[model samples]
Target: MEEEHKFIIRTYSKAELAHLYNPDMPLVSAMRKLRQWIRRNKQLSSALAEAGENKRDHSYPPLQVRLITRYLGEP
Candidate 1:
């Protein structure tokens, strides 16, 4: 039998999530990098848009966060 750990999904501000992905980088730089990653990922971008996500929004809803984690793998 294989054990599968479930990841908890939650809302996160863009900066917070970005920092989780890049702890060593400055917050602003991490944010920029996170934005680039999202922008460059077509599927994630469209999914976010379809879920009513605004590019300028400061936070991600739980659903959007899940989508991001799915594509980018837990950051």
Candidate 2:
């Protein structure tokens, strides 16, 4: 009798998730864009931030928000 091997998939890290979602894009560039967007759209950013800070089950703001906020001052 031959023994069969089973393979298990592992979850991605934060960096891995980012790269997988946006391949070929520099991490820094992606973050910058996200921040910029957040700065421009304060309401959205605030909502998302609140959700996260409060530990609510809500999706995060788009990556553009993170990128935009990083480069530009928050609104």
Candidate 3:
């Protein structure tokens, strides 16, 4: 019998995240701003640091998701 594995994977791409952040803004511009915001926010930076490089460079972890939702308004 094969082993079974289950887990929830949560990640948003640049385009998706951009749209989530601001639908009215241009995609490239929004993405740039989002990156800057992630780097500038203390709570977000710390969360990213704790989550490590994988979660930092690639996608937002669960903690970051909560923070983003709280701060950025339901992204």
Candidate 4:
């Protein structure tokens, strides 16, 4: 008898990420900035969601800014 193992893997490419960043952007060059930003700051997405649910004032640079600063460092 032989033992079998399974594993999960994920992959991402600059072009793919760029497309995600901006669907409107030219396929040739979407910049991928937003995609990279999200990848780098996964926490931001969660934090933003939380802020939205709480109905907190997101306009001012507070919740988001603070979270971003803590994760990415001072601007």
**Top lDDT hit:** 1
Alpha-carbon lDDT of model 2 = 0.45
The reply for model 1, stretches above 4 Å from the true place, is 1-7
lDDT of every model, 2 decimals: 0.91, 0.45, 0.65, 0.48
Residue lDDT tens for model 4, 1-75:
899643112232435434543668785556445435645676876775665523232232355445544554442
Better of 1 and 3 by lDDT: 1
The better candidate by lDDT, 3 or 4, is: 3
lDDT of 1: 0.91
For candidate 3, list the clashing residue pairs, or say none. none
TM-score of each: 0.87, 0.37, 0.62, 0.37
List model 2 lDDT by residue over 1-75, tens digit each. Answer: 999654223333334434444467797665455445545777756654654532242233445334323444332
Give the number of colliding residue pairs in candidate 3. Answer: 0
Looking at model 3, residue 60 earns an lDDT score of 62
Please rank every candidate by TM-score, starting with the best. Answer: 1, 3, 4, 2
Candidate 1, residue 32: Cα displacement in angstroms equals 0.4
Per-residue error (Å), model 2, residue 25: 2.9
After superposition on all CA atoms, how large is the RMSD of candidate 2? 12.6
| Alpha-carbon deviation at 50 in model 3, angstroms | 0.9
Clashes of each: 0, 21, 0, 0
